[model samples]
Target: MEFGAVSDEMEVKAPAAEAWKVYSTLQLAKLVVEMRPDLVEKFEVVEGDGGVGTILKLSFPASTPVFTYSKEKFTVVDEEKRVKEAEVIEGGYLNLGFTLFRVRFEIIEKDEITCITKTTIEYEVKEESAANASFVSTQTFVEIMNAVATYLTTKQL
Candidate 1:
């Protein structure tokens, strides 16, 4: 098994406030569930202002059952910077690893009716539990980001 991380970036046609509504809100988890109901079985916000220090209980469904990493503890949120951070993820059945994930959304207002949003994801993988687990996580990371972008973009209009 080898430790690895996945990062992805995307652009959205929405203003920063619009983007923040999706990225900064805990409700955005619902968008993830809506996009991939098969992967996101259950998600519950545990704490915080729903902005920072929020823990999400993430499980799975068929075709994308998440057997590892049961929960994520989000610790940072800077609306001014459009950034949020989470850590101490349980890489269940994998490395029992501790991981951190950060998402930043920058809104570029192009016009009154349109805004361009750029999103970035950075991850830190602490250990490798299994080769299969590593593969699954990396793939899921990309899928999750893409799903978020898709979810937000579809609502832009």
Candidate 2:
């Protein structure tokens, strides 16, 4: 198997707590679907309630050339540390021969009124299908972060 990881961070003009309120819950998925319909076509909760063990299904627009849907389960949700992790259990990269695909979000406190949104993608693919790893990128997460930051800052105004 081949393992790979990518991460990116964005400075947000909002408190860590405020950012956590969205990142730690399904609100982030909702925001992404609402803000980027071209990227996410639908968001649905398959099980649990926005917490650890929760499963979410995301559908991509038809224009997307890759997988159409993905199901991810929340493996970790740490409010104290402001970190959350979701592992893709089906579809998405898994269909492309990836053995594991996980996304992690960290909201770090920069100050009383500012915070950093860190996003990471970690994956393992079979050596025979290592080429599929190229599809993994942090660009989508960066776009989501931008939308969330813009929403949070605007709401604070």
Among these predictions, the greatest TM-score belongs to: 2
Off by over 4 Å in 2: none
- The TM-score measured for candidate 2 stands at 0.98
RMSD of each: 4.0, 0.6
Q: Write the per-residue lDDT of candidate 2 for residues 41-148, one digit (tens) a residue.
A: 998899999999999999999998989999999999999999999999999999999999999999999999999999999999999999999999999899999999
Candidate 1 lDDT by residue in tens digits, 63-99: 5443533666666777776666655455433243324
**RMSD of candidate 1 to the true fold?**
4.0
Instruction: Provide the lDDT at 29 for model 2.
Output: 94
The lDDT values for all models are 0.58, 0.95
The C-alpha TM-scores of every prediction are: 0.67, 0.98
Q: Candidate 1 regions off by >4 Å?
A: 1-5, 65-69, 91-142
Summing lDDT over every window of 10 consecutive residues in candidate 2, give the lowest-scoring window: 35-44
Candidate 2: lDDT over CA atoms?
0.95
